[model samples]
Target: MDVTTPPASGDGPGTAPADFTAAASPGTVTLAWTAPATGRETAEYELYVNGRPTTVIQFGAGAVPSGRVEHRLTVAEPTGTAWAVKLRARLPDGNWGSFSAERRITLVA
Candidate 1:
């Protein structure tokens, strides 16, 4: 695991998009995010759940200029009351930007 540099403060081109949605089952949640404004240099995105390396999804060839890019994630076969899901950008240069605000969803019984 690589340590990422702290994002710029005061909202000076350093804010990530917020993703949200409710899951139908326990330990599951929906995810979405706007691409990083400053981290356009990123190559791929690393989706994380509860601070762990969860998934690596590839970004298209086009440069991630700015503004939001939304994505959806599902926890297969959830097994708990709720789940925490987060998404982050991974630059092609091996630098990771900031992460989206974590979201919590309850599982259906």
Candidate 2:
């Protein structure tokens, strides 16, 4: 019998999360996004702050079926420093997809 491995999933995830936003209050920043279609696999989200990978957030199957995922991060940047926040999702295959549109926010005291 001939055996062959199935083709790898082309490229990466289909599309990035559509609704991504960030807000800053005092010394913390809040990021939120609607769960993207994961092609039926669990998705791991990566958070990029000012072009650096800062954190990874995971969403299991059916984790956020009705609402969006939100996280609050404490920042120590000086006031008036603008920060760029972006997000990307990874498939179970370890491929990181395109990043979401960046959201810029200035920190407050």
Tell me the whole-model lDDT of each prediction, alpha carbons only.
0.59, 0.80
Model 2, residue 7: displacement in angstroms? 20
lDDT of 2 at 99: 84
lDDT computed for candidate 2: 0.80
* Candidate 1 RMSD to the correct structure: 7.9
Pick out the ten consecutive residues of candidate 1 with the lowest summed lDDT.
Answer: 19-28
Candidate 1 local lDDT, residue 33: 58
Tell me how far the alpha carbon of residue 31 in candidate 2 is from the true structure, in angstroms, after superposition: 0.4
The collision pairs in model 2 are none
